[model samples]
Target: MLGTDDELSYWVLVLTGPQRGKVWLVTAVGAYPYPYPQPEAHGFAEWVQHWKTHDGWWS
Candidate 1:
């Protein structure tokens, strides 16, 4: 099982410049946000939910 600290830590990366519209989910270890909904959300549930509620994703 992942520790509380590990489970709670995450990041979102939005690309700029030529890449433009790419957004990513980054973590202390690492992550790759998928092209589809609810992909690989296991440890990032809290953060993903927060992002969704706060005008992110489909909001």
Candidate 2:
């Protein structure tokens, strides 16, 4: 997890997986999948890069 707010409404920017490189977002727990799996970009740096260009997340 590279960045996030103190509030625990969601475990934002969470890194989970065997190797711990996957990036999950916008959920109360890790990889819950109720709202979003949201894990698209693999590595933290890659996820950041995607965030820099993604539509809704950046807006």
Candidate 3:
């Protein structure tokens, strides 16, 4: 899920997967999915990371 804090004016990211669950504080800056995974390594973390980075949740 994705949401924002009106007072703080920041974005939030919630991630859930088979391997783990995590939350991230996102900003409208930076590039797409800082750490991308290769075709051979498609783990849960990599899957979530790809979306988190490329999806532009902060935007």
Candidate 4:
């Protein structure tokens, strides 16, 4: 969940397997920016790139 002076936002993830299922969640809380829009747009590309770049590092 994200909270700001003006608005709030939240993110949730759920994963399921053949037998066992996994669930993950993340929350962000910060002050709203000068613009009235949401922050998800600004960092989305970077986030996806990073995820793809480092997602397999453990392997």
Candidate 5:
């Protein structure tokens, strides 16, 4: 449930937590075109890093 309107060209990140916790991280590429898909787009690197950084083997 993350996407930008035509008026705004940016990426939206939706992080849904357990038990209905949700977060959104919205940022603009600033006139540059983003060639990535929506779900696998923003915060993936950081997400992976954080996942490995904190939740190692706990999942």
Candidate 6:
């Protein structure tokens, strides 16, 4: 999960299987390994871009 600066928090996740390489935005409730909703992107490149954009913020 990729955490955001917000308290409730937004997360970017890379899924596997049929949805492999897809990106998803999740709303975190408690701690690590938060529950995710659905995939927001189905492309690997899109996922990479999202990760890079948030990497600096969440790193």
Residues 1-59 of candidate 5: C-alpha lDDT, one tens digit per residue: 34454545433344454312222334454432122233323244544454457742112
Model 5 per-residue lDDT at 47 = 40
Span of 10 residues, lowest total lDDT, candidate 2: 32-41
lDDT of 6 by residue, 1-59 (tens): 55565766655555666655544445454432221222234454654564577744222
Q: Runs in model 1 with CA error above 4 Å?
A: 1-8, 11-13, 36-59
Candidate 5 Cα deviation (angstroms), residue 36: 22
Residues 1-59, candidate 4: write the lDDT tens digits: 22122233432222334312211223265433211243322233433454468742112
Residue 8 of candidate 1: its Cα lDDT? 52
**lDDT by residue for model 2 (9-55), tens:** 34244445563565555435544321243434355666566567763
Best by lDDT: 6
- RMSD in angstroms, candidate 3? 10.1
Worst 10 residues of 1 by lDDT: 1-10
Candidate 4: minimum summed lDDT over ten consecutive residues — where?
18-27
Relative to the unseen true structure, what is the Cα RMSD of model 2?
4.9
lDDT of 1: 0.43
Overall lDDT per candidate, in order of appearance: 0.43, 0.46, 0.39, 0.30, 0.37, 0.47
Q: Which stretches of candidate 2 lie over 4 Å from their true place?
A: 5-19, 29-41, 57-59
Best by TM-score: 2
Q: Per the 3 Å backbone cut-off, how many clashing residue pairs does candidate 5 have?
A: 0
TM-score of each: 0.29, 0.40, 0.25, 0.24, 0.22, 0.38
Residue range 9-58, candidate 1, lDDT tens digits = 44443445542344444456565543225554323454455556774442
State the local distance difference test value for candidate 6.
0.47
Rank list by TM-score: 2, 6, 1, 3, 4, 5
